[model samples]
Target: MLARVAAAARVRPPERTGALLSATLVLSVGKGAFLATVMVYLLQIVGLTPLLATAGLTLWGAASAAVAVPTGLLVDRGRGRAVGSVAAVCAALLVPLSARVHTPWALLLVLCVAGGFDSAGNVVRRAMLAGAGGDSVKALAWARTVTNIGFALGALCSVRLLASRSPSAYETAYLLIGGGYLVMAACFATTSLGAGRRGSPSVRAPGVVGARSLRTGGALAAATGILTVHTTLLSTVLPLWVTRHASVPVSVLGWLVMLNSLIAVGGQLAVSRRAATREGALRCFRNSAVWTAGCCLLLGLVRFAPTGWQVVLLVAATIALTGGELLEAAGEWGLSAVLAAADEHGFYQSACVLGETTQGAAGPLLVAGLVTAAPVAGWIVLVAVLGAGRYIAGFTTPPPHKAIAIDS
Candidate 1:
């Protein structure tokens, strides 16, 4: 019986790809712990005032934003593995060093460095998967599952540690996360996924992506940026819209978030199965846009519905949003892998990250300016824009056959 169960689990991605996914899981676990404990550590252990801590966080964000594109460029130069390893090592070191640092300046400096490494590390992982041939969407779907589980586990573990309410326990948690990073670094160092020599030739000297290809990539990036509004809708827009406008109880928001997370953790694999090929991926992308627009429409409908019906509409909207989120994620992974130039996954993914960055910077303002002020009009405009994306997505062509092969 045990052997049968083990065999059942063996029907998974190739062994070489496990390194990246495992690393992501371990790193995500550490990040989960860090998220729960960092503020307390900064205030209680590092002796930084709340304002200084906020400033340190702000500096870290700035540093991450500044380095996002450059790091992608670095990965495109065939240094994905090296860069990921360095970032992992730095992340591992940052935790222990953070416990030692007390001054705001020192904390800011440490956070800034960590932030850059963090962004670079994400780029490396995504680029590696984009170049890793053979069912990139499915691999990413598995990755998302592992990441969610790891984060949930880490958060639960952190809760136990924090229950002690002792400074030493916090230190121990940081050290534990450092150990996870060490494991992640080792995975990158030993794995063959995009770990070419440190001094390979430039991937972008010339003729890497033609004008047409670059333009297509750019448009995809813009669409991705627009899709980031889904995140904003979940994190910012929904909370405000529901509480202030939707006439629903505040607790429903928490339940909705839980539901979304659950769906992401459980449903991604099933959704990714249909996205194995480029045509299927494009189909999913178009459908995701339709679902996203439907979510917006549902949210808009909440205001017009009766009191009891409002809850139903709101729930429906959440479901639609989650579906769109999962479908979009799978489709994007497939698109990134399918549309990239040969050996240029890093550059292509980096270009896509530009959209994420744009969303991060602009989404909040747009939500405040549009959704908050005129919910119906705002949603209609979003629907129109995303509807247009459905048409644009149909134009994406798959890369050549050889380009889809796994990186050696």
Candidate 2:
């Protein structure tokens, strides 16, 4: 009976892939709902002071970053599905608890725990995407496209909550977000694409094995970390730049953000196709550097432009930035998958996640400080930094013989 049950749990690759994407969609929507209304809910409904709220969020980021590598190490021990499902379930319970908490300490505790679970789930999911058969980059691209769509739909649904501005409305949104995480947990529980032990262990010591894996994958992780500054630039810096420096009305920021979403949703798959090979991935990185640098330059010049050209340049800059975003995502997915050892997906993925999470934790302060201190010079420095990072990333590419054979 146990053997039969185990066999039954082994889903086909196509079915597992579908489940993974469905899970991605669900998770994205939940995050979207939470992100769209979280600040207002915390400040107005819960009546927390801005400093407390910011501190709680900072703790959340810190917790997530702290747990990423450890969670990845656990996943490497043949527990990917179990670990991911458990993390999702924990998040499902913690999110609504967060909504109900009135005390500042409670809010901080709930967010810190939830953030750790969320980061663990993300690392396992990325590892699963790499292990999913046939064109990992393509699968990741589709998942990203679905994510954008889910976020858009979730945000649109939250409009009523934002409009009502009532405690009940915000609580209801949290309940729905929790429900989405429950569904995501179910998806992880049912899928087996990236689960289970690969084979017998190496004779080497565990510490040596882990250190070797990290050493092998460290360069790609650094490159990914450096590139993540673009996320900070787009989401935080650009909005502040437009509001403070450019003459455009604050209302224009919404359209610019929407344009970025539209471009990512439409172009990600096409861009990902170009990253199917090592050479192609490198090309994508180079292209991303060019597009991103151009975007910074254009946005920096917006203050000097006539009012008419300010909007025009803003739109153009957004388009360029979105293009860079698409290429960077595809290249990262390709390189991470190709460079990873067959049995060490979790280790390599966790390293990458550690890099990304560290950047996410520090990026806001770093980018905001630079941009606010010197708007024009900050943008110039960013352009140079991005260029330098891309150049360094090119040199980090392992020889073709070391590359994993990911099917196109």
TM-score of every candidate: 0.80, 0.90
Question: How many pairs in model 1 have backbone atoms within 3 A of each other, for residues 3 or more apart or on separate chains, i.e. clashes?
Answer: 0
Distance (Å) between predicted and true CA of 359, model 1?
2.5
Error of 2 at 21 (Å): 0.7
Task: Give per-residue CA lDDT, model 1, range 1-408, as digits (tens).
Answer: 999668646758644688788888888998888866777777766778988876666566566656766666677666777888898889888876776667778878988787777767777777777666666667767877888788777777788766676777777778888888888788877877762234535444522455555666776677777765777788678888888786678899878988888988868887887777778877787788878888899988888888799988888898999999888877777777777655567766766666665576567667657877777788888888887777666655534453344221
Best by lDDT: 2
Could you tell me how far off, in angstroms, the CA of residue 273 lies in candidate 2 after the best superposition? 0.9
lDDT of each: 0.74, 0.79
